[model samples]
Target: MTGSLETFLSTAEVHDAVFSLRPDYRAMLVVADGFDAGPSDAASEDALQAGEAAARAALRDRPVTEVPHVAAWREAYRAFGAKPQRTRNSLEAMMRRAEAGLPRINRLTDLYNAVSVLHQVPVGGEDLDRYRGAPRLVRATGEEPFDTVADGAAVVEHPEVGEVVWCDEAGVTCRRWNWRQATRTQLSEATTSALFILDALGPMSDEALDAATDDLTDRLTRLGPDVSVSSRLLAQ
Candidate 1:
């Protein structure tokens, strides 16, 4: 995946412009596989809290503004519940846009989420090593069967075919198409190295993509020196 940084930012700019015009607009960029969920550090927790706070603030004065992507995602998960055959929804549709055709967002997941907030777009990262094999962004084929762990204790079996998914060299790394991640490949506090990704879909401008990429790279560097980040436009 090779492209100028400017190309990425331009994509982001287009999304930003659209968001600016919406009455209630919110977006989220998330790092999926980087941090260990065992126990979030105060700082990491703080960052998550800050994001929640920002979302709340955005909705404080509005009756029907755009809702934060994360909040919407949570709702989608609840609506799906624990059915035998889970399927993809609107939120997952947006997430797949980021996972497809992007260079690995290194270090479990640092760069992806950093830019997610910057661009107001929901983004995600997953660890390829933990999976059975190399991961691919594709719609789930009913023929492929998989299991995912949620909240550490509950195991969910989803038997939907043609749902968007990240297929690792081994098997399905994440099940919710893109809405929720599997526990096996999740990043941990012990992870010091990783592949990061940032995603945006729809009609986006070059400038926004550039800015988001630059901003994410800069932030990742400050967090740790061993991180490397890159980008790719999803192939249609």
Candidate 2:
């Protein structure tokens, strides 16, 4: 468990944190291996565009907030003192933009966004290279540093105490559950390996999550190289 999150999932460090998740809390951790997050080719870009189009068509008449999966994430946000409307979850924000035509980033980024829209789940990824240690999810102390870029200038901020966050030895990596990711672990063209976290709540069954993980893994492996994937499901 040298570099795996499972090392601390059941350890004393996370015992109290996992206990805090209410009865309905659920999540799936998907870790990919032998990835090549380099520049996308024509086919990859085309698939990305197609996925966005499908999402827009599916959510055309309804807003993201009305979607069951997206709404569940909103509840998770409120559970930690966040205003979901003001601070939209990453999936909700991406759905909005997809409706208007999603922005194209590198292959890895596009891959998750496409899968997210295809399954209507909150899919977040991090560059394993920048991560300081195994993953940890706990209540922030409001003193841990989180690095990000503001107006193109580097900045470091701290999460409010008790706000649920994903962090490591370095500092906070994601604040307020799936709301945001730190700049330090952002996936880039050079990223070769990564971890993706899929968030879910009640009504999202284990079978559905396993299917989604398979779907994403299949697509990512097709991108290039002998990509491998390992996953875990955390539910209450």
**Highest lDDT among the candidates is held by which one?**
2
Which regions of candidate 2 deviate over 4 angstroms?
1-21
lDDT of each: 0.43, 0.77
**Candidate 1 wrong stretches, greater than 4 Å:** 1-46, 61-118, 150-156, 203-206
Q: For candidate 2, lDDT tens digit of each residue in 71-158?
A: 8788878887889989888878888888667767888888888777777777888887777766777888899999988899999999
In terms of TM-score, how similar is model 1 to the real structure?
A: 0.56
Quote each prediction's TM-score.
0.56, 0.89
Q: Mark the 10 consecutive residues where model 1 has the least summed lDDT.
A: 25-34
Give the clashing pairs for model 2: none
Angstrom error of the Cα, residue 116, model 2: value is: 1.0
